[model samples]
Target chain A: MASKKDPRTPAQIKLAKQLGAAIAEARKKAGLSQDELAYRCGLHRAYMGFVEQGRYSITVATLVQVCSELDAKPSEILDEIGH
Target chain B: MASKKDPRTPAQIKLAKQLGAAIAEARKKAGLSQDELAYRCGLHRAYMGFVEQGRYSITVATLVQVCSELDAKPSEILDEIGH
Candidate 1:
């Protein structure tokens, strides 16, 4: 369960999910598995799965690495609603 | 040292610092101490110090909590460059 009264609203969750969808699409476009991307990003494979599932709340550092591994920009990941 | 090649860039770091400053300012405006904010935010006091010092990378969860403790919003914390 997430902390209630936190900054992430339903809107933010929706946005995060949208961002995760974008990341999954990008990873597919680049022909990379979740494990491959996680390795490239220097994160745990399970963490990558959580990211894809929108189960984990991420930091800017994680965001940068994931996007870098996927050859993405933060804006790019966020620009499209669902990819 | 933090993770190299991490998502946090000089720009993102700048933004975070600015955000931290905004949070500190808001806390002051609300007349709360570091300990008080930390307690209300459910974070460690030392962690709050690191956040204020811009030495720690934070998660969205943490962001939500800190901002909430300050009676602030994500946009409010970020919209002001420094205040």
Candidate 2:
């Protein structure tokens, strides 16, 4: 179990938070509803919501699909998230 | 648009693919149904499936949530995925 106090490090955790928020923002910018994004990416609406909330770690495949749906790339997403 | 001829570098893509698979494997190992994991991590279940398939790029916040659900750290997840 990760320690509640900075479970990991602040830098990584901060990076993750920003990244998650960026993805959510990007998804919205793309005019994608959670379900729409999910459908396009072959993801579940619930999972898409989870991702938006930054409550789960994601796989590369998921990232790719999300990017594809957004018409973006990993680098662009990463840049948005400041990572 | 990313070129189909190695949209990204093969190494990065490969690393992403492996990382995606590792996350899926870890999610399963944690005895977490995608929905259950999503619930625990405050995620959407559909995104979980997308992640499992390595179809998308994930945010750090999402990564943290997923890792928390799996009782793992980012390093561990990265290590598992060979990134």
Candidate 3:
């Protein structure tokens, strides 16, 4: 498991947080709770919570799963981060 | 280290390949070789090649590092995949 305090630069951390917020916003827009979304993505509810909190370094595969479940394009979520 | 054959869905794999191609294209547009870009991002050259080849799952932190070095936004790369 990756540590909560992974070795990311400040800019990277900022981007991760922004990305997390975007994901959370999208999930809300799609009218899915964290648990429901996690179930749809086949991810653990706790893991999904961590992701939304920006507490871990998220993998591209996981991102795709989450986005697919939310009926969102990965680019759309990323676009909200402005980077 | 993640395996080359990670258990990603077909859609995820396709998106990964597209993202990799976009990264490679952006790197070229910035006139940076894999070696140069990897050095800038503090990643191994072979690892960078794997990323470009979409042979492994990439982390958001790594994406940020690469995009920063390439003068790109994460959304731009994901956008090229149209998702």
Pick the TM-score winner. 3
Per-candidate TM-scores read: 0.55, 0.46, 0.86
Cα shift from native, residue A62, model 2 (Å): 1.7
For candidate 3, what is the TM-score?
A: 0.86
- Tell me the spans in candidate 1 whose CA falls farther than 4 Å from its real position: A1-49, A61-83, B1-9, B81-83
- Give lDDT tens digits, candidate 2, residues A1-83: 87456454565556656656877888888887788888987678898787777656665556655777787775556644543
lDDT of 1 by residue, B1-83 (tens): 87656455686677567656777888899899999999987678998887887766776557656776666765445435521
- For candidate 1, what is the lDDT? 0.70
Which pairs clash (backbone N, Cα, C closer than 3 Å) in model 3? none
- Predictions' DockQ, in order: 0.18, 0.14, 0.67
lDDT of 1 by residue, A1-83 (tens): 86555455675576566657778899998899999999997779998887887766787457656777777765445335421
Sort candidate 3 into its docking category. Answer: medium
Candidate 3 error regions (>4 Å): A1-6, B1-5
Models sorted by TM-score, best on top = 3, 1, 2
